[model samples]
Target: MNLVPLAAEHVSGHALLPFSVYAADGRLLLPAHAPLADVRVQAKLGRQQALFVQRADHDAWRRGLARAVDKVMQSNASLSQLAQARPDPVPPVQAPLPGEEWEHVVLALDRAVQAARRDVGWVRAVQDVQAQMRAMVCRRVDEALFYFIHTGSRRTALYSSRQALRCMLIAGEAARELGWSEERIAVLDKAALTMNVASWQLQDELVCHVGPIVDEQQRAKIDRHPAEGAWWLRHSGVTDPAWLEAVQLHHDDSLAARAPSSLTPGQEMAHLLRRVDRYSAMLSRRAGREALSATQAAQQACLGTDGKPDPTGSLMLKAVGLYPPGCFVRLASRETGIVLARGERANAPVVAALLNAEGASMAEPRLRFTTQAKHAVCTAVSPGLVHVDPPLDRMQALHVYLKSNGPAA
Candidate 1:
């Protein structure tokens, strides 16, 4: 056997050895032909610093390595082709305009669902749909959310779609902050969008129930939705393992109990989705209960199922910030405003003032930078707390105004 350093830089995919790979102390690192993508294998190799492989298999190993390299090259070329096939970029808008973008997205989703039901594999169409979602998410998160909320809120049963979108947004923002690559972020975005599709396909009345899903039959549907969604995606020709895995495990609470060492990359993404999903569901208004305020949602997200604090929950709060965009808040000056965007600090966000300190609605919304303590958020308030004239139009106008002003420094 020949000894070789098992550094990440040198290893790309699975490295096949004719015999077992061993560490300096003679502990077997991996069996022959095992994929080296496992984090445990990588960690063990890292700790050992080197591995021994059979020299007799050098020729066979070289052949296998070449095949692996060729496969990776082909995969990358395919991904590149997909990336290059992007649709024309939507132009930046000073004001959010009425457009058929949401309708188009919904139509694409409907088509995908139909294709899945027919057992027809239309991978290209699915990819295009994901591309559209990625574009909308990157360019206009607020506008995308506006459509999701309006459409889903109109039908109580489809509220989960709104919640899913919220979770997707939060997860996307958090992933971006973590410096994940654009491609990875896109995968995350698509995964979040489709993760709950199966559940949404159920009868609207059944999914829209206000309280906890205590009925065994209903709970069964809820529990199976993740896997069902993943199965649909797979049959529709989604070959991305990470994307498929994320959809399947998005609701797996057991991930919260696993030690970090045992978590896979897929599980890590699942963990993020789970946390965001729980938080979004809590903040969402349902049949019998009022939605939790942003602050309360944040507080709830910071605790584990057992009521103890969790680091991931804390990270989620920090990522989402004190006043996430679109939420209403009362300023220290008693002026009520809607958060426009995240500011330089998590606790502070740019806000558009809808009311004065005296509680009178403003004729035109004024942009306020909450970086200054006087303008900082006092607490999250209910939407009805503000006296917004022609509330819908004013809110839309304010969103446009915020877009025009750009983010506050």
Candidate 2:
């Protein structure tokens, strides 16, 4: 069983517990909805390093916390509420932030990676987490891409797992666009996310590390990560040859150009993973290097080692487009905006303008269709340059926004 560390606020005295709390060793310390007033439970909690709950319930617990906050905001409740009695186990649900779901999936994926350190239940943990991602991708590819793109630009922590999520989404979407079957897509997603299982912490550190790989042992570890990761996955109950091979061969892009008819499933997945892995990493921020803009990343991701457009790279472009949703772009009008959705053509994206031509925040975000010459994408913008946060939910509801009020006037 997977367990997540809980924060103190999860069991605040002002609200009932959202989920049963557990001690580090998995003993139930407090049942769901239990009041914290019990001195016995307080005593039990005092000796533990931190509280934990089953990984699956973590979301419900979080949603409950958000619910509580919304309630307090609406009803003028506060720490003052602690003095009064309350009986409800859960606060009423509210609309979640656009990026919250991405956060949950990435957190769950991280837990699954941590679970790999154990001999038991790692596969189930990974499958459960990735299944959630696949469902999101399937339900709405646009929404999934929107959150994925929007998320990576701002967050600075958990680089390994978050990068994996980015790769998984790219690979999954690319796979589906290629008309691969459901089972194939599932295996590819699992493989893409966990391909760095051996170097999860190493990647996280190196991404933020200012200097070169000076240590010999560290260099060797980096060199051997792919093979070692595959071995660990095999030992941890991953029996799919395709999945294991993808992890081992993930760094080799040379295989990406081979004919699909002649390749084994593993080789195909490895090729896709190799390209998308690098592609995703390029778009992500690193302390030591500047991140590439969306257009640059897309171009660089698809080129072969020989400096030419590659078949696999071409597939990614065809599938995800040149300016994928949630990426930033500069318009012909000099307004800076984030791509809201892929338009009828790849070069033309639906945009939500965040900055006027002068680089000041707009009176209100204006919707633009790159299909129109006046708003055509002139260049990709650095995400860091976008200080003004755009309304993510509204962008996701682009169709409604346009129907109610057509594209930028």
Candidate 3:
């Protein structure tokens, strides 16, 4: 597959031998006119008298070699320059830790639920136990999230493990804002964790196929599993009845009615569970459903089943801004940034500008804090169109900016 230079004087007018010629080392020297057996060839690069029949004239060979050499040199220069470049750092923002008392409760809940799921003997006790467990967990979850306000935006932080972590953080923030106690935060965290567990039971395929298929054959297997998942929770030795019910009822809101087994308490958890569960599901990118920007998702969430945007959803958007921290957004300022922190004011969400309109890196990020009266109220604009994979890696890069800024103005 190697090429060699040749003298124009070496070959005469068109002959019919195999047009291709290879050197003794199997390096192709020239394309020959005759077939391989009849074609004579010579290798110009190697020392041996390797014979070759002509394909291109000597002038054409020289021009090609020059072009190739030029390309290599240009590529090397660009790579070297890129290697030496220094980029500006994004600012950091602070997020409060989950309270100590609540943290222990979440740890215990996770441990108990995980252990019970593994123990077959506890299966029959599962429903009774999970129901109580989920209620306690739900209460604690309410407490943990009490500090930060809850909004309806698609504004979400991305991470696999952070699915649990972020849910706890946001929920804890919400609970604290609602005047929840430490125990309440723990309950909410547990509820969040349990809801995730229920979703996992549906297997991978169903969760992904949230497509528009109306036929019975398509819907048959889909309807039963959500209820079945609840049953599994009970059988698995989950001691808390509320947690069991939360798992069971989480899906109830999606369908027509709760199962006959569903109790009044279970019905309550089901409603709250759906909000948290669906919020989680929407935030995470799935297979068939188009992944939405945190803003877009929030918009859609605001537009409830009635097909009108929900007022609460607007509040969520306003609260989170159009883009929450860890979201990728295209700014009206003609820059593309990732939300590093939420603004204290409803309108401004802090951002770490990543790129200019020309898709070049910004020299230095312009921090936007909504709390400052001087800063114009920057609204949460639409998100940019970039597919985010391995969301956690991006979050690491984004966190620095978030930690430095206060809540949006």
Candidate 4:
């Protein structure tokens, strides 16, 4: 979609807007006919920084010039139009570069999350960043999982923020599957985003700290982060009790045999958060420790120490699939590939073959539907074992959207 820059007059105090407003980077700022009442929203457009409207709005005000030109031609008066006017050229609005949001959003989100930790006034800022990330996740869930999952391991600099965002996305995916209300999901997303707020900096530090943790203080902080994080959120003006409770109880590994459907909303949401948080942590490499493969991580998340299956974990698999996107796998035919999307069944996923049966890189990744016997997944494989560095952006853009602006059906 094309965009045009807006001046202050374009959006005045509390007026119902005629057109939707967007950030300079294409994020929606204010919807059509909505009042611009939030101080934080106005601040984004201040300092002469650019805010935008759809190009059609600009064209609407420009069409009058065209009408006057037509009127002069209809009059048949020679030299009546006077000297030719030299108009000052107005520059065209630029579009965001391809994959710019996906590439930049991770860093942008990290900054927002870190800023929020320092100041309690950054509520809207953090939520705004989360909304943009959630849009990307909802738009292309598999691509999002692939983008963050791959980035999450390669760089531990922003592990705390990246892991939290990944967990929020996973919760949203599962929540959508369970047919939860949008309002309920919003609360879940917020809780997931801030579950580790109390030890965010510590999380990033731990990721790069090699060997056994000799820091007893840091070890104790990790053990009590859940309750402490909830308290921090309360001081930050988080009013939703359920949201706080979810964050507080996020580490309740003691949940035994409790079904998701029977649990209270807060407990259910917390259980979902716990399942995703632990699942993502296993995939992200910690210091000298190698990350667990997707299969190993899933087994840990889904099964208890006694080998009993957790019902909510079962719900996660049903929602996100057995071998979710971003994990590498070996097909029955000996070809190695990356899972691109979850298929109808847990075992069958949409895969792109990176290496041939002979373990050589293919000229291009070949998309395979693992439902077919010839293409069924044989086992999970490590990223180091796959010889090719997957072209994530190109492969992501190749996905066919079944809807106008969302994941495929």
Candidates sorted by lDDT, best first: 2, 4, 1, 3
Runs off by more than 4 Å, candidate 4: 1-99, 257-262, 305-308, 400-409
Clashing pairs in 1: none
Clash tally for model 2: 0
User: Per-residue lDDT of 116-165 in model 2, one digit per residue for the tens?
Assistant: 87755877888888888776554456666766776667665888988888
Q: TM-score for model 2?
A: 0.73
Query: What is every candidate's alpha-carbon RMSD to the true fold?
Result: 18.9, 13.1, 22.5, 10.7
Question: How do all models score by TM-score?
Answer: 0.66, 0.73, 0.49, 0.74
Tens digit per residue, CA lDDT, model 1, 314-385: 677667676676677888888988776667777788777888888888887777888888887888975434
lDDT of 3 by residue, 1-409 (tens): 2235343333332232223445444334443443323334322323445554233433344454456456656677576554433222212222224233334443444444445457654333323333443443342322222211111122222222234444545544444554557664555555555455533433344444566756675465456545655676556545566656665666664532445345454454455445544454455554454345664566555457776645434434544445556555566656666555555544466555656668777556555444454443334343335422213334333443343222334
> Global CA lDDT of candidate 1, please?
0.65
Model 3 lDDT on a 0 to 1 scale: 0.45
lDDT of 4 at 176: 88
- The lDDT per prediction is 0.65, 0.77, 0.45, 0.74
